[model samples]
Target: MAEPARRRPMRADARRNRDRIVAAAQEVFAADGARASLEEIARRAGVGSATLHRHFPTRRSLLDVVFHDRVEALCAKAGEHADRREPGDALVAWLGDLNVYAAASHGLVSSLLRDGPDADLLKRNDDCQAMITAAAGELLDRAQRAGAARPGVRVEDLLALVSALSLAAEQRDDDEGRANRLLDIAVNGVLLPR
Candidate 1:
């Protein structure tokens, strides 16, 4: 396996500039999604456009950094939820959180799913899907083993369902609420008792 490339630590002022840019980018992205302007981000960060470009040469690069932490946190949340709740409860709660995240993030998730120009740059560096699958798989396994979930549920299919439901919800006026509602419907399908 190839060893990951090491990053040199940033200089103090450069570090500050980068941190400010990330903060600005997060706000702008929340309000504007992936098409949020780089120049506007620089302006908000109180940095020159050149500084923003210097720190993040491409929009994809900046986005990778901006969303990376959130993905990590989501994976971590799965573990925490697993520990605190029953297996089925933890899976449902984490899926709810994932639904909200996907609905809110908007364009960023679509960008990550793209297989065009940015694919080459993101393929190895961005492991959001893998990380999520690992976390989700553990939860699903526990639920299935405990007989609280169906044995055939696959992590990939569950994630895809969350993404699709969230995308549909994003078109609604009540984004998160709609996403949660849709997820609950999926989670609890109508059945006739045998």
Candidate 2:
């Protein structure tokens, strides 16, 4: 039998609407948490609630779209960073970006960590973690090859350290200072002894 025909690409207008909706939802949900209303999202997107429903029938559907978009962006950033900088440097830079993203998204990361029907969301999140781990491992290997980093440092340990540091940074009123301090401590801890 012949294969089924491929669907046509979305029209520019439809694509614009979708992008607008996602942007609005990102802002609304970040500010208002998971209970952010669909009507508010539609208003922010300059679309009707019916239109929002047409695109995303439920809040989870909208969240899935927004969440996937963020993951793809983070993955792409990791690839770009890997290309543009030394592995360790790239990993460090990406960690900073991830912290900023987490801060801006406001509880999105924590919610993903929770178990539920959204457990798959956490699994997808693990893909990003694995990518970061691989990148960090490569960087650590490079630093080790250069005698710049401690020989025994593991990628998982480094990731855990960064996560803890980021959480600590988030708690501080002087977040920028805290983030810098966290990064400094992370870098220092990974450094080889003279």
Candidate 3:
């Protein structure tokens, strides 16, 4: 096999520019979500559009890196729950965690789900979804095998539920506990006991 090409190290100023751009992207994404303007990010970072583009070739690419760490940590939290709780309990608890995270990250993930036209852009670019799916699948499989979850449950459906719950809660009143409360209702069901 031929040798792979070696990547050159970024210059000091370039590294600073990249960091500043990321910091600015975080702020802008927080403020405006997936629709945040790249030009605004560059302006906040004290860099030109060309410089920002040089660092991140596309908006999707920038978003991926900007939210990568949070996504990773969320997935990691799944692993933390798997062995600590009963399979069914673990699954429910993890969904609660995911609901909280999803509600908090409404800006970023709102664009990843099937919510609107802009969401399509993230469909192709998302490794974040894949990672979450894998993590959830592990806990889900355990639940099913242990008879904690019904066999018809699916990772995709679970994720979509969390996404939708987040959107609904966000649209409702400003009550911070609404998402978690909604999740409890969904998981426990709405029917009263006979």
Candidate 4:
């Protein structure tokens, strides 16, 4: 029987470069959407293309890492609210964070879903989506149990509502104002009657 391959810790400089590349990719992808340039990301990261490719050989791999990190950050934020805040405030605040995450994506998720058939890529995307939805559902359930949120609202409904509002905000002249207005309406609609 063949032995399993062993993994080694990354050297400090390589770890720094990897972190830099991921951060640069996030910023570039957010600003330029799905068609952002890898070379530009490398430049932004202060690394060579060789270094970037060494860490992420394919564009899809880089995208996956960037999105995975973002999703995990959102999950962490939601978890923090759930742990420390009042139930109603936790749901509302986490939903606000989710809205910001979706808005920052700028429709790149649609592009990602439609652009590839790579099984690994699709699976990663699905996993991230599940994580996000589960986080939101937990917050919602807490709020409902606390008599703050209305009963019977599904996580899918909440996510879809936020997605729509974020998309509309992107298309309008006053994006910040429009998104906040829409978010306020959605949040208010979900709350139990005073």
TM-score of each model, in listed order = 0.78, 0.76, 0.69, 0.92
Number of the top TM-score candidate:
4
Residue 64, candidate 4: how far off, in angstroms? 0.6
Which portions of model 4 miss their true places by more than 4 Å? 110-124
Q: Per-residue lDDT tens digits of candidate 3, residues 52-96?
A: 999999887887777776678888989889979987788888898
Query: What are the per-residue Cα lDDT tens digits for candidate 1 across 1-194?
Result: 99999998879999999999998998887677676789999999999999999999988888888777678888999999999998888889999888877876766656545535554544654588788889889988988888778877788888998999988887777544888888988876311112
Indicate the residue-level lDDT of 58 in model 2.
79
Q: Can you tell me which runs of candidate 3 are displaced by over 4 Å?
A: 1-4, 9-24, 37-54, 109-120, 189-194
Backbone Cα, N, C clashes tallied per candidate: 0, 0, 0, 0
Q: Write model 2 residue lDDT over 65-175, tens digit each, in one string.
A: 786677578667767777898655666677667656656554665654452555465465566567556756776677677776778888778767767766777677654
- In model 4, what lDDT does residue 174 have? 59
Error of 3 at 181 (Å): 0.3
Question: For model 4, what is the alpha-carbon lDDT of residue 73?
Answer: 96
lDDT of 3 at 79: 88
The window of 10 residues in a row where model 2 has the poorest summed lDDT is: 110-119
Off by over 4 Å in 1: 1-8, 11-13, 109-126, 174-176, 189-194
**Which of 2 and 4 is ahead in lDDT?**
4
The residue pairs that clash in candidate 3, if any, are none
